[model samples]
Target: MSRPHRPGSGIRSAWWCEFSTRTPAFGDGDERVLLRAQSAETPTQVMVWIRLAVRVLLSGFDPRDTERAYHWLDHGQWEAVARLADGEPYAFTAAAGRTHVEWSARPVLFLPLAHTATGPLGRCAEPALCACTARGHRCGGHRR
Candidate 1:
């Protein structure tokens, strides 16, 4: 089973995406961070999460570039959108709220869980006992 998303104290993920392609050979690399919040106390909204995810995945370009984004989840795989050469951020947001030509691109957040991994809470997805998850206590098991 997967770890239950705790919300307030969620996981943080960061990755570098080479967004700009002005040089082709040396793209403008940027860092995209997503503080995955599973708890109700999370401050970031779903759209913000999606936007940040999109921003990281679709880094680079301006908010006025004309390149269109082409992404779709087909057959369990998230296909990559067409490279937005000088693409803009608004394009993706605008791509939503409308059904265009063949590609009816919309921002419907679909968070599919991956296979479970070893968690801090021994035998459980919860954090280990004590303050190990934060204060650095040598916790054992999922509870104190």
Candidate 2:
């Protein structure tokens, strides 16, 4: 017989974001699904934006309209997803707990760009038109 496939065995540690449109109480909608991750060693701006997008999406989720709401994985919750990934169930819970505590202690400041007369003058308005430069990425400065 073949041994069960193990997930996350290659990576030492990582940060994962999960979203679900169902509640545990009902046990019907997709729950504890692993969505994406950021390496523990180096995190990129794109991954940070993905996390921010999750936050924004969750904030706007209306359970009343969809009959379910989405949420991110945090606060010592990781067993179900770990099982699905075929990793040590408690590993994620422990790591996520540590990460949660660490982040709660030191919160990053995020400032949204100010809107212009036409519209936001940054990639926040039109990402496709944004240009990459030596210094950093710059917005196309076009109105939507």
Candidate 3:
């Protein structure tokens, strides 16, 4: 088995995010099933807009529509980032806790910024799985 990546720096920790597909099993076996998220706790409209604006400013206009942006994130960027960070590899799904994470990307997939723990993690420092950099190795910072 592989060891979980520990965040080494605050910025790295803040950048990497994760979600699991396993949900608490409920009801009888026949009726029970892993529940997927229905909606996001808070939508990613603002973040998406900011990212899009930055992209446009840096590059140029993208011909894709809004949904495309969401898909690109849900299936593309988010997955790549998680994989780099060694996050549990699983599709976007919610648990019975009723914690719904929609869009499965960016602001939606990312844990709320407030949950971050301050200070260094000592020897168990969280590893950074930076996508903007090279392979999924510790670059710096922590988030979980």
List the candidates' TM-scores in order.
0.19, 0.21, 0.20
Against the hidden true structure, what lDDT does model 1 obtain?
A: 0.28
lDDT of 1 by residue, 1-144 (tens): 899876653343321122111111235543332222222112223224334445454334333321333232221112222221122111223222121111112222233344547533234443111222455334443333
Off by over 4 Å in 1: 1-44, 60-123, 126-144
The most accurate candidate by TM-score is 2
How many steric overlaps are in each model, in order?
3, 0, 13
Give the winner by TM-score: 1 or 2: 2
What CA root-mean-square deviation does each model show from the true structure? 15.9, 17.8, 17.2
The sequence of per-residue lDDT tens digits that candidate 3 reaches over residues 1-144 is 999999644332222223223323466432222222222222233234334443343222233333454565456555444543453322332222332222233322433233337654353332222333335545344222
Model 1 TM-score on a 0 to 1 scale: 0.19
Report the alpha-carbon TM-score of model 3 versus the true structure: 0.20
Which residue pairs show backbone clashes in model 2?
none
